[model samples]
Target chain A: MIDSQKPASAQDAEHHRTKMQKRKAVQDKEVASKTVEKGLLIVNTGAGKGKSTAAFGLALRMLGYGRRVVVIQFIKGAWHTGERKALERFEDLVEWHALGEGFTWETQDKARDIAACQGAWRVAQQALANPDVGLVILDELNIALRYDYLPMEQVLADIAARPESQHVAVTGRNAKEAMLEAADLVTEMTLVKHHFKAGVKAQEGIEF
Target chain B: MIDSQKPASAQDAEHHRTKMQKRKAVQDKEVASKTVEKGLLIVNTGAGKGKSTAAFGLALRMLGYGRRVVVIQFIKGAWHTGERKALERFEDLVEWHALGEGFTWETQDKARDIAACQGAWRVAQQALANPDVGLVILDELNIALRYDYLPMEQVLADIAARPESQHVAVTGRNAKEAMLEAADLVTEMTLVKHHFKAGVKAQEGIEF
Candidate 1:
């Protein structure tokens, strides 16, 4: 019985050592792989104001990190005080595509509106497929989908198939059910009050 | 002379009418488009501690919106914590890939680390290429790039080639020069004081 006990004790000791060594190795490995790769998607929806503004703030944060970013403005084809000037500062780092035709009803030309949308969508598709892009913002795209100019299924499919580490953001009002369903993050900007309702026009830099 | 004046006045009236019509059209199309397309990249990087936390906050927001969000945690894959637990509630919308193999000296396996990084990058690439994915967050991509595990050039090129409206984000310590140059908006989070330096361990919910 003494001899049996001795062997059992020795075996237990060896097992413990092995477990310790394995754990240590795992810990060591973890330490070795200290780097990480992750991406984010932000959606600012609802009828509130500042959705785009908030998204832009996040974009600025990413940009400060020296990361690559892209912005696609949907219904906002006209020149705006904020993006028009701020985006240009990035120059090579930023690529802006304006949907020159504006909204659907403004032109009263369905063909022209669709063509402009297609043109803008082409750029968006390219940005989505590119892995180097750190951030891509779809400013005011939600309304485009609501107007039936852009296909929702195609958009959702593209997002699902993008690089896992890439980050994406969509800002606008009335976010569709599918978009909300497909998104990893959604923010609804509820409007409590607005200066526009009080007869104040959109101010430069502040509103645009 | 009288006839000439009459013609000039008529032409001026016609010009005024056309200008007014154009202005009215522009005003009528002020409704913002609401559409969310796939292929977005968001980056959260700086000297601050809340980059990842903020990114996760967005992920939670998206989950609440019923969207699926995949988080590939680099350099931080370890025991489960508060963020992990809270995200687990929406298992379908959230996924965590822990690649925190610890610091470089710990593993002493450069080849293995590279391979693992490539594997993780492949997943990221797939996510970026997907259209159905509304948001993709690269948790700590900056660290990987800083360490040179992920090819910076390839990353940049991929970003340049992505779809037009897709959104994306990247977060980490120090962003690369190339990344900042390509980003549309850049924001730097200056570090003030961190609690960790004060001998405080990570807290639940707040730090996790």
Candidate 2:
């Protein structure tokens, strides 16, 4: 009788252990699922067209969902056709700031353009600091960094420190490797095909 | 000589007549600062408080720079918290989608919620065709529209026709809208805020 009882007890203990292991596995899975987060970063680059346009589309998607968003246009100051006319309607929901005094060649003043870039950076810092802002798009920012108008290290640091829930996008040619690495999503817009190279200048209401 | 003088005078008159008019008032002010176009609609409605928090802070500001944006919040989505967030980040780039959905008890039932709303006619139609879709935030859409599973005529039409540049957002008390909205940016979070309400609860990150 003692031997039989011992065997039965041992079997019960083993069953309990198996049950505990299964429970633990389920709990671990639940935690993992809960911790999963969704965030996005879009990069539009290369010698192509529609970089800013793509960024703008993403920005609108986020906004329509009631996500707070910020956009900083780099190396573009002249009243371009699109932003000035079409984008201003949402004056209450959008903010537009021009950073370039004009392209470097047009102005022939690197120092002035750099100063303007610094001012834009200050604004970007403020936007990044805000926790409520969901998406921040740096339009043509890569060009500014390539030109050395904005400090690349500082920009990278700021992006790294942004609120975890926030999404940041950088658009322009030659996006820095650091920026690409920091991004949750990176898309390079290659010049597979474009109409402008055919000498068809940008038309109003279309390119703008 | 007289005949030659007459012809020259006529030529001068034509030239002067064609010259552009100069104004005493330099109307250099951007007459139409930005183009007014249809925008996406984002709705955030649920038992959670982060719907608008995520919407205004993350999406609206992104649209402010160059993307056309519009926001319409049903109910009292216009509390000081949301207002403060918008003021600080967007700089007047967002519009209030106000309808005073009122308290649940005051106007309860599917028929009433559906009746109160004119459908997503105007906003949805615009978002579908507009190309500069930066962001659209529809704060608290689920509770209002889901009371009856409201006919998705306007909503579906807009989504179907939405330009590549447009995106839509919807948030509210129940996830029924999520199913209906077919969101490109969807987030459903389990609640963690439990302190201040303590049974009769309403707190900052959890209730606002």
Candidate 3:
């Protein structure tokens, strides 16, 4: 018998082998069915803090591939962030625009906010038109849209008009339903726990 | 007379200014209350992609600060992913260990899988002991736990036993409830759309 001299652990191994062989067959078949490829409109939105952080990470990944990426910060324009500083090393591949005047509340000037947004939008439009830019990250664009700083219709139109193979990543919380519907991929970052609630100040490299 | 000089857009701008001023005052006060500082246990989990991607991005940020970082990938050992190759460029500042036999189904040998995990665990424990490593990323550790490749209690205890100032990032899906309860920050990646369903094969750099 197969078990005549086999130890208990060996028998267990034999069972596992048979089980996994079946699983591999199933997974391989499933993976083989997928074949479509195209540029994606990726959205990062929710209550969690990493939406922008994740987008910047995607920006760095694209740069690692020798591709061009542009980051259009829709908020915190006046604040210098760690991602921006770190990406400087990849200057040839990364074009960053921390162009917001500030958050609308921080600036406290609606007219000025509108002017700044319009200017940023113009720059974004230019980046979208460029064929060489592989990815366009509209950082915190959701916050701008939430406050009605920019017209949603205009924003959607611009995104729609971008090059076919140009990937776009939009980040911020409370993304409009329309934005979600328009996206090819959307990730809602759900906050399970936050250190900020425990009076932990945002760390420099980690938080920024 | 007022309308003669001020257009409707100007009137809207004035309204926005007042609203934002009040918001700014409230936010500034709320932000001032947070002041504590301590290391955190960060968890990235869920069915969607980017749990590991976001964690790696976080690791890069830590490395940017000239801090040492280590990544212990507990699954997909046979797969030489693009991220691994890209990260190798930061060899001086980063240590990566892809120590799995393969995925559970592919390996189909529970004993061998357990041995690989235990080996990775030893490396992880050693890294956790080193005070110089700022961040320790236990990539795919959850999958091993899910499959009973390692004891959950041992994993949790080891994490709890890390250096007081050391930050740990655990990535995978179906994280144990106890792990989430112990974490300082947790983000669940909720997938709204995946191109994989559209038959898109994993592309290098982007998928890896």
What does the i-RMS of model 2 come to? Answer: 16.8
DockQ of all candidates, in order? 0.03, 0.03, 0.56
Full candidate order by DockQ, most accurate first: 3, 2, 1
Badly placed stretches (over 4 Å) of model 1 are A1-37, B1-208
Model 2: residues with Cα > 4 Å off, grouped in runs: A1-35, B1-208
Worst 10 residues of 3 chain A by lDDT: A78-87
Q: Native contacts retained per candidate?
A: 0.00, 0.00, 0.59
Cand. 3: chain B TM-score: 0.91
- Provide candidate 2's TM-score on chain A: 0.77
lDDT, each prediction: 0.60, 0.54, 0.81
CA error at residue B30 for candidate 2, angstroms: 28
Error of 2 at A108 (Å): 1.2
What tens-digit string does per-residue lDDT give for candidate 2 at B62-135? 54344555565554433435344433334454444554455433343334445445443355456446666555
lDDT of 3 by residue, A41-157 (tens): 889888875787677667657766777899898888854365666566677878988789777788877767777878889999999898898889998888889888899999999
